[model samples]
Target: AQSVTQLDSQVPVFEEAPVELRCNYSSSVSVYLFWYVQYPNQGLQLLLKYLSGSTLVKGINGFEAEFNKSQTSFHLRKPSVHISDTAEYFCAVKGDTGNQFYFGTGTSLTVIP
Candidate 1:
């Protein structure tokens, strides 16, 4: 079994500021990780993923995440943000062979101009 947690429920950053969204997970088996973002009035979009290969993964919109197996963490980061970057971010964990995915509660990122 696996579960994910988003440490912060909300985060506010000024425009062009760097931001990091924290995520932690617990699982008994090998897993794949993912980060998704949902902009205001929009559906969830896949930010980045760690399906295999490298531990560091980059996604769309200048976002990236590094998978830390020992720490059981997959945190998202962006060097700078835009007003349009404001959205809800979620972390997910899934067993390598499972169909089910465990998702975090989600963190709201508000980019203040």
Candidate 2:
């Protein structure tokens, strides 16, 4: 089983500023990590994911994340954030066990313009 944790429940950043939403996980078996963004009244959108290969993974909207096995972390970062980036971010872990997914409470990103 795997459990995900989002360090911050809320983050407020100025427009065009760099932002990071920290995520950590604990698991007994290898798992897949994912960062998803949810817009207001919308379903979650994949921001980035770490299935295998390179530790650094990039995704849409200039978002990127690094997988650190030693630290059990997959933190999401965006060099510059826009008002449109405002949304709820979720950290998820899919365990080796079939269909077992754990999600964090979530972090709300508020971009000030």
Candidate 3:
């Protein structure tokens, strides 16, 4: 079994400032990690994933995260955020075979202009 935990339910920031959103997960077996972004009343879009090789992964829109094995965490970070970055972020994990995924409650990123 696998589960994801998002530390923050919301993160408010000003435009063009750095931001970090915390995410953690637990699984019985090896799992794939992903970060998805969702705009208001829109579908989720894949931001990034950590499959095997690199611990540090970069995604679209200047976002990045690091996979920490010992800590069992993958935290998303962006140096500078925009008002357009305001959205809900979800951290997800998937098992080896099944496509079924476990997602975090969600983090609402409100970027102030």
> TM-scores across all candidates?
0.96, 0.96, 0.95
Candidate 3 least-lDDT 10 residues: 23-32
Cα RMSD for candidate 2? 0.9
Task: List candidate 3 stretches off by more than 4 Å.
Answer: none
Please provide, for model 1 over 1-113, each residue's C-alpha lDDT reduced to its tens digit, 9 standing for 90 to 100.
Answer: 78899999999999999999999999745899999999888898999999888999999999999998889999999999999999999999999876998899999999999
Q: Candidate 2 lDDT, tens digit per residue, 1-113? A: 67788999999999999999999999745789999999999999998889999999999999999989989999999999999999999999998769967899999999999
lDDT of each: 0.93, 0.92, 0.94
Better of 2 and 3 by lDDT: 3
lDDT of 3 at 81: 99
- Backbone clashes for every candidate come to 0, 0, 0
Best by lDDT: 3
* Model 2 residue 8 lDDT score: 99
Compared to the true structure, candidate 3 yields what TM-score?
0.95
Order of the predicted models by lDDT, top scorer first: 3, 1, 2
